[model samples]
Target: MKIDKDRFNNFIHSYTKDELFYRSLYNAEREHPETFSQYVDTLDRNFIEQHQLYVPSLHDSWFPYISENEFFQTYSQNIYIAKHNRYSPEYLHKHEFYEFFYVYSGTCINTIQGKKQTCRAGDLCIIPPETKHSIAVFDDSVIINVMIKSSTFHGTFFELFTNNNALSHFFSHTLYEKTENNYLLFHTQSDTVIRSLIEDIYIEYYGHKKYSDSLLDSYLMTFWVILLRHHENHLESFLNTTHQNLALPDILNYFQANFMDITLSSAAEHFGFSVPHFSKLVKDHTGKTFVQIIRNIRLEKACRALKTTNLSISSICEIIGYLNPEHFNRIFKETFHMTPSEYRKKHTNL
Candidate 1:
């Protein structure tokens, strides 16, 4: 398929919150005059212009009961895209497949099993089959729903995610290895690679002629590999996010935010757990002890600073919470197999 990539990107990026809300109001008014105000939570001009307070009927967006060939091309051509517009009916029902929703532009409120999650731009959500979920989206939200078949998700494809604990735990926890963890929300940080892959799929589907289906499968494989590559850097973050423990979120977030000075005793006290109890819990869940976790976080931060900043090695160590420059340098070299200066110089050239 021949696609004007520039024009497509321009059109995708064109809608902001204001434009989306105003356009929705215009459409709603045209479709059902004077009923738009009835759905508004607040009766004000600012609300009318900047936010879409109403939702359209769910009847129009109902799932189709049809064969794969009738739906698209072939049964093997399982992957496809669906759009979630605020004006369209909400697809609350579940099916026998996976739906990965990527918030491509703006933001939306995603409700999975009655729990609400505000997914901003660049966020990706993986919703499994038989899960009761719906998206209470707003104006300006471009939710790209990538549907993956269960049959195609196993064997060699599934092993890619299973190689790591965080993603492995997440996908497995959602796909019936465990319960209580329904879906995963990945903050992709507006990765251009992911955006490009989805756009390629969109273009190929719309302009399908000859070999687009096979090309789409190739794009999907590359897309998963890229996502895994980018996400491996934040394994602990993903673990903390997918953790089913109730107290872990606050403890993990606070620890990450204050990694410079946090200790096991202080963290235990703060979380209202005894030192030994807290230590055991952390180990059981994360497979790493408290000090090891903090040390890794600090070292990761120091590595980023080394590559991105022009700070002295001693200052870099201090910034990452090391009092002794020699100790920091020793560990840095041991962990990364290179000195800070050498690592920085090598990455800078690349």
Candidate 2:
């Protein structure tokens, strides 16, 4: 369905918060005089049409239901039941929310950031914000999908991950193998505990009993602590490398702020180091060459622009610091496995 750009813009201007958009439609209906009915109808129809395409819909057999109560204000989390489906579209296809999923009944394959791994009945998957992921059900599945606001964890557990380059690298690239004591996949024993916790969450979610939201939030926090403990234990070994001593968080910040004007020599000079030393330090920390890191950052910006802006591919490339269109196209294709035009077509208005 084509978006009514005028209507969408008007809707945005009318609502202060995303949560109020629906309520605003109702208020607009009751308060506005002439054309009120038309405004409400258009808002309702446009919202449904726009979201229907953006959010993934499992086949009818999946039996998906969601409930969010006013009391549950910490984060937006929900339970999903997917009976059987080959795959669900990428969650980040339209939004950049951090997501977590706990499989309850059957096996599924999760593809995140281009890496694939099997997530079984007791396994849990955590997806960082802006990471692209899709799920393929191997059998009938019941899963709880929790979408946590970035702000909720931005300064807490999320900061822990971002503080260490190795941890961030592992999360960003979808590493599945156990490193040291940390295993992305739970041990059989831990899996059972996590499964029980997930079931408790589901019960609290659907029950909606008095104080249920508080109980559910507590369970989520506990589950996160467990996961973080495992991740931290496993990541300790990688943190011992020389690259860890170079202060990667600062470097990442610098790269992000100056990506539009970044050069290898300039980056090295920023850290008060020789070009070769700084390059090696970055390589050691991220396991990506300096050029690769810069390219990845540029590509990420391009992806965001493609999804959220009306700019043409050439314009996007220029905005993201690529002067040569052909060179940009080649790199974009190599990184995303699709041309800029295709990416824009798939994600625009989503």
Candidate 3:
């Protein structure tokens, strides 16, 4: 029997109301039990019965292998979203790319790499590549799978994740780690923004509106930041964090990009730390003081100018945030063990 389009759409729209679908399916199965037979195979168009759901079992095996190309339109985009009315039992299988899921409604019983967790609505399951996981979908539950290739995270996000936080181990899983269990569960049931953004992802994935991919990328990145920020807020213990490499490159990159006007006080304020705390953090992470970092960056620029450009020493001094040529010369020589003029002669063509 063909699914009632109206009833099917209702279940899709009102995900939390799985009982409505069950009641409808119950009525449909009363008339046609054979209509529900085709629901076993996920690839079948009739896999979703309007009024029926298969009883999920405790099967421990490999999860189904889903090809990236089947979901993604292009490798460069490398992202796709798939929704399911939770009923089938997932197997203990792993994938080649980063995969995460959002519980749209009800709960998802996820056994992740030998660990089990009950994922409720608004919970996010972050499973890294090659990690075994199985999801036992219960009746009246809906799940949305967001698949992203490893290439998608080869940017600033990777740096931020590995920027030496105490919880960094929970997020980034190495492809060739000695040991393999890695996954994260971001519990965000009370967060409205995360929930709304996730739902919008579902809409955009199916609707395919203009610039949906770009918009989704922005949303996805922001979603993780929010999740991490939420995680950071709950961090009450910092006693064992002394050994972490707090070398936040993105923060340093910002100073480099805006070196002209960045000050110790301003930089500290930008990162929401006190001046003393910021100074200590910078020193601990980079082994350089705020002034030293700024001075080193300015001197490097002066060196480049002396070699590549025909600017005079006095002009270069003024250009590199220095008012006195003698002062600039003294500092540059102290750092490089050679005067600016001598360095220029040695490296640049006269």
Residue pairs in clash, model 1: none
Q: Candidate 1's residue-wise lDDT over 1-350, tens digit each? A: 25577677665555555546546555676787678666444445556434433333312344533333344334335577755655443445666667788888888887776667688888887776556677755465677788776434432144455353455555544443323326667778668988888887778766755655456667877887887778655322222134554444445556667788888998999889999999988876655688876887788677656655778888888887999989998888887688988877764322
Query: How would the candidate models be sorted by lDDT, starting from the highest?
Result: 1, 3, 2
What is the C-alpha local distance difference test score of each model?
A: 0.64, 0.53, 0.62
C-alpha RMSD of candidate 1: 18.6
Which is the leading candidate under lDDT? 1
Runs off by more than 4 Å, candidate 1:
13-76, 176-181, 233-350
Ranked by TM-score from best down, the candidates are: 1, 3, 2
lDDT of 2 at 215: 60
Model 1: lowest-lDDT 10 consecutive positions? 234-243
How far in Å is the alpha carbon of 80 misplaced in model 3?
Answer: 1.4
Clashing residue pair totals per candidate (backbone < 3 A) = 0, 1, 6
Q: On residues 264-310, what C-alpha lDDT tens digit does candidate 2 reach at each position?
A: 99998878999998887677656678887678677867876776678
TM-score of every candidate: 0.51, 0.41, 0.50
Query: After superposition, which runs of candidate 3 have C-alpha atoms over 4 Å from their true positions?
Result: 1-77, 159-163, 166-179, 233-350
lDDT of 3 by residue, 229-346 (tens): 7755533221212234444655665666666668999999888999999998777655568898788777767765765678999998888788888988899889868899998786
Roughly what TM-score does model 3 have, to 2 decimal places?
Answer: 0.50
Give residue 308's error in model 3 in angstroms.
Answer: 34
